[model samples]
Target: MTRRTVRIAMNGVTGRMGYRQHLVRSLLALREQGGLDLGDGTTLWPEPVLVGRREHALRAIAERHGIEQWSTDLAAVLADPSVEIYFDAQVTSAREEAVRQAIAAGKHIYCEKPTGTTTVGALELARLATAAGVKHGVVQDKLFLPGLLKLRRLVEGGFFGRILSVRGEFGYWVFEGDWQSAQRPSWNYRSEDGGGIAADMFPHWEYVMHELFGPVRTVQALTATHIPQRWDEQGKPYDATADDAAYGIFELEGGIVAQINSSWAVRVDRDELVEFQVDGTQGSAVAGLRKCRAQHRSATPKPVWNPDLPATERFRDQWQEVPDNGDFDNGFKAQWELFLRHVALDEPWRWDLLAGARGVQLAELGLKSSAQGRRLEVPELSL
Candidate 1:
């Protein structure tokens, strides 16, 4: 098979995710990891063209990567005959418009989540993309994580029989940049800029929640802004309008339930990474940020609820860290490769904008449930 050198056009190549996920992956594949393969030992990586709003930044990035082509006009890049795929990692508010324009340009689309702020926008994008007959995808990085992959293997192998419930804890304290000179981009704390814990993270949980267990049936949630102020990249203070923390409970298609607490304000005292605890009628498993544990029916524990118990005492003896297994996990980079392969050859890729729209659906439901003080059932999409 002749290796397809897929030419990629990238929008927002200077943004955080655009740089880390799209450009860095290109750098690694071309310079370090060696370009992608089609499993049959044929390379699939393409020449990448970086595009951004600023000409100087785009030129600098292209020079840094030893890439010659850079563009400030998205329309010109879209019209470029050499560009096969148009990838967007732009802000949440700009995703739909960029994707719409890309679709019209007859290029395949690969983009970030929340496809848009609303489910309707997301679904409409999907419809239009389908009408244009373009291959589209959204990044669901956790599905490819090694640790989570192991957890998935366990579930598929029936390690946790009669699966009962799942508990997910995710977050880390993002400093407010007041004392030690803050780091995170200020746009994240601004709702107008499409930054918030809910908009940023719901897509991840939507994929993980379904992959780890099953489809979400209903959700009850509340959002909070722990830190009301933050400094932007310029060190100027601004009022933080987006939610920094969110708590939600969702019921799966089966009778299974999941509780997820996501935050940008909470510091790690227990697990430093996102973790899941799955309990089944026959057995139970605890998946840590970087590790996992299992307790089978053979070793079912006997304990009583007590008021004077230490925080660490409950699951200590019952939980043992799952083996690192020496398997490397590329959280987002792996997903990038998968999308690349899908573009090169028509391989099956499950993470798409419709899936992302489902996440936006859940977030909207969460907000509705919070506003109405009730649990809201997630209506299935037309697909």
Candidate 2:
């Protein structure tokens, strides 16, 4: 079997999501598994060069992972002719320019979303990458998730006949630093730093809704900074200008309505940190991060609406747990592997820079909807 090493310049590995999800669980895990087999006996191995501003953190991460390359010089890394792919998990505000540079340097681009703070920036990057003739993709990890995959299977199998609505409940209480430190980074509460629930989560919702149901047609949203002040990493109080909570109702192409609540202030009462309950004409399903439960039309119990007395029926027991019929891999790694193949073998892959731009468009429209206090139509990008 022929094994070819694909050099990747990975920026922002020092950040939380970058370090844990992309670096450790995805890239390193792929390396430990002896790289990805290309089905035709050839294997594509990832050789990552860690790039970040913090020298100490980068060095520590590289050394811990037994990686030979770590550098603070992003310019030097991008200039390297040997680097085939440039992956960014940097802060949202810093992503556009870096990705532009990578595209100009003739490198395949893969990054986390929202691709940029604005739709124009994201679309421009897409155009630049396409004109440069370099492969590009964005991290749409939720679609690969076990629960969502199961939901997709159900949808494909005609379990949900004529899907009607999808309700997503996400987020948990992030403590203010007075007593317990905030679970999220301090910048997440600062709008100036490209932080907010809408910016962070609307991208996920965009792809999820698009991939599962159809493209989003219109959006009506409400956002609020419920906690105006919060303590930072240094135990100093700072004003949180960004919205911590966002309520959105999206209309999909197939007339499917998707309502999602994203918040850092709300306490979780559901089965998981995030759950999507989808109802259709024939059945209903609730999918969390790892598990999915379905109630088919035959099994759905009918109960009379009674206002006076307490209901004795166990409503939750009507649904059956969806079994893990096959081994489920890490969603991040799964997408990473596909991206790697897309770069190495020119494989057919759909989640490209255009898709990323669409995500950014949705986010921008959602924010606009909130500001204008009206439903806004999502227009398709001309480019």
lDDT of each: 0.81, 0.93
- Best candidate, lDDT: 2
lDDT tens readout by residue for model 2, 1-383 = 99999999999999999999999999899989999999989988899999999999999998898999989999999999999999999999899999998998899999999899999999999999988999999999999999999999898898999999999999999998878988999999999999999999999999999988899999999999999999999999999999999999999998999999999999989889999999999999999999999999989897999999999899988899999899899999999999988887898999998999998998889888999999999998856
- Give the lDDT of residue 268 in candidate 2: 83
Q: Which is the leading candidate under TM-score?
A: 2
lDDT of 1 by residue, 125-158 (tens): 8888888988999878777776687788789989
**Where does candidate 1 stray beyond 4 Å?**
1-3, 39-41, 305-314, 324-326
Q: CA RMSD for every model?
A: 2.2, 0.9
Error of 2 at 205 (Å): 0.4
TM-scores, one per candidate: 0.93, 0.99
